[model samples]
Target: MSAENEIVPPPGAAHRFAVVGMGATGVGVFVALVRSLVAGGRAAGAEVHIFETKERLGAGVAYSTPHDCHLLNMRASTMSVHPDDPDHFVRWLSAHPGAGPAVESEYVPRRLFAEYLQEFFEEALVEARQCGIKVRTHKSVVSDCREDARGVHLIAGLDHFVFGRVFLCLGDLPSTAYLEFTKLPTYVHSMWQGAGLETIAPDATVGILGTSLTAVDALLQLRGAGHRGAITCFSRRRALPKVQGPSVRYTLRHVTEENLGRLTDGFTRQLEFAEVAELFRRELEDGLGLAIDWKRVLARPAETFTHTLARDVERAERGQTLWYSILDATSEIVPLVWRTMSAGARASFMTEHLSIWSMFRHCMPLDNARRLLGMATDGAFTVASELSAVSYDEEDAVFQVSAGGTTHRVRWLVNATGTGFALDCSDSSLIQNMLMRGDITPHPLGGIDVDFDSLRVLRRDGSHSARAHYIGPLTRGVHFYTNSFETNLANAHSAVAAALN
Candidate 1:
């Protein structure tokens, strides 16, 4: 290592803390750490180190979009940085003139949300500083992290910092399935990275590899940039996410504490997928205040997917849907529900129902859904499933995508399948180094193996790490709703509380 790569702590530092990624998750973890330490009167002489390769501290890749067309999938009223303060974000937005439109029930631009996050972190940082906490921000990536008797050591760029406790808030990993197409000029492996889309011609035919929310982002960006090219989105299941409906509070009967206790006998045994399905079915019927056919709701014909979208859009417009509210309630308790499942059941759910569950549970805003409907009606966009293959023509500098027994030629292809969490294929050197040494193992479902309650990493030898914890999406194997902002913040609070206690 070079001379500049080495870092030394000041003499007699009392306690040291490190947050490995300063995105939204990292920011949440950092704030929780500050709050925990301060509440316990342990903030003095505490050193908190934040590591992030990017210049921005709080936005992360998801909310850092510069494009105005990209909007938050959920309404602003429901998004709050702190779990205790449900309306904190809404209050903040109301005070800011640049928050764009009304705070509640509006799909504001994601860039503005990034601004909110930045300002939120800064406000918390001010309080942390008042408590005499030493905050160090590093604009470098952590290459490796290891723990021993002394403490946890993080190696970033050339510097090494030792911490009493470390929180791994590493954000989304890149899409690993597109590794073979990384070198191709026509292939856009990640739409979140830089201004790659700006290079494509206005009229260039583009194909997106998935029909999830990420694909919607790319489509909106293309439209915003005045691209009139033919856009085709392909996936193994060509189902798009359901549209968000008017906000309503729902009473969750089957998914409640009492029902959960009856199922688990107060956390005694593992759960089956069938049991969970029953709970979901009951909750849906109860919330809708009607008994409905389960088959029609769960399984729609591929040709009728658009029709379903239109029907849901009408429900949303009429404010007659309580499904989104039920989704929100389920999201709040997902960790508990996920942990109840046996490993085999979790794996089965991942293989069989995750795609469909995600499509319905994680829907887009109604306005965006309307735009999609209009696009489909105008023949400006088409979706296909069973995406078998994609190949590039070097001579012609275009891509040939084969999906649903048809081939389409396009000048650009986007891998919008979203992030994958396989540890072996991770891009982070920190994760790779830890996985190589068996410091952390991959969960059978996906993401890092961890104790669901404490958020402590489970070692390759089947022991939990004392000085290290994970508090982000990587814990999704055990916490299936890790993608939601509310879930991530809640997990961060739990991790910080456990570490402090």
Candidate 2:
């Protein structure tokens, strides 16, 4: 490409900024961009473009549910978009009566959180307008992105545009691919897509893939819709997420940054996996005021998975799991710990500990756990561990799932396995194009590789791309906590600061 063609700026445009995928992550980036542009006195007639194919911009797939049965996994108190205010969303909820009660400790519906995000986005836009920034929304898919000396060029449909910088705040990747079940009428690739769980027959024997939060959402939706068929959830570990408990405040001890420094010998070298694990063990013990029974938790020879879940829920009900706050507090320094870990240690964490970490960290609400236990006790739901050899019979139009020497057939299959992060395995055209052109490289753990702090997309040649910045779950391999709104918002702030600098 010629320098003239690539280096040219948009006509009459000063400081053009583009944010792709206007989901929760994108909205957070938008807030950071507006604030940075306005604070830097660059918002006068600055052009800001947001691209999304969804009807709504800020809600994203996670929060776009209209069902009242779906609830936010976290409490209302901790979901603020702005870190400085800390209670902005909670305060907004207090002011708006239509959003149900504004109790900070309550687990509000995801739709209510969506409303809060939309309102927050609009308020930010209004502030942008006050500073003479033009905010434009493009309801279309971004096909390709290529960078040059001048800026980044984004292709949306037949239209092409260049921006000073682009924030690829792309939300969760597409659902996991099921090549064997492709073209089968009974197989649903994604439960979050069009028609959702409603497409399943009311009396059909339904098989749900994975026992994560997504599976729980599907289960609740099906129950709410009056589905009475047998529902079996497949899990490799047969472990359901623990229940969310009442708000607990605790002091940090062994997980402190100072302790991390001491462990690393004043940050002279990379951290080992064992050292980090030991620190966490101490943290839990100190925070809980009781030593955790590692042997019982790991072995669990006598208790069922559902029984373990019930025990945790019971602890939550009795306000005894104050140790949960330790994990909550770890959020502040997770990036530091994640980045300093050796590559091999990081990979070990991904392979051996990630699932258990998720089981504890991404727990469901207590009410949801109760409902799940109730359904399990009623014999309407069954969870199987180590499900292997999932095959579909085209003639019978049934999916045969095998686990632990038992085979079960279901007429309907739902791939609620949640989003996959492997960039090479991604079916998205834009991501594939970027990888093909070396605009981004795949991380060893998962997702696209990027810089440790700023999140600038790193090319195959080990150079960072000035044109593109990624701030999403894809960065989890390096950042370790990109799944939360708090982490994404923090990432956006850092990216914007780096870009401005």
Best of the candidates, lDDT: 1
lDDT of 2 by residue, 231-266 (tens): 988887648887777777666777778987887789
Candidate 1 wrongly placed segments (more than 4 Å): 1-14, 102-105, 302-306
Worst 10-residue stretch by lDDT in candidate 2? 5-14
State the local distance difference test value for candidate 2: 0.83
lDDT of each: 0.84, 0.83
Each prediction's number of clashing residue pairs: 1, 0
lDDT of 1 by residue, 1-501 (tens): 676665544453239899988888999999889988899999889889999888888889888888877889877777788677877778888888987465654788888788888988898899899999989899888899898755888898889877888999888878878787888877888888865688778988999999899988888888878888788999886488878877887767789767887899888998899998888888888878899887876774645556766887898899866777887777777788888888888999899888888888888889888888877777778888878988888888888888879988998999898777888987777888999999999998788988887799999999999979997878888898888888888888888988988
CA shift of 281, model 1, Å? 0.9
In TM-score terms, candidate 1 sits at: 0.95
Clash pairs of candidate 1? 5-158
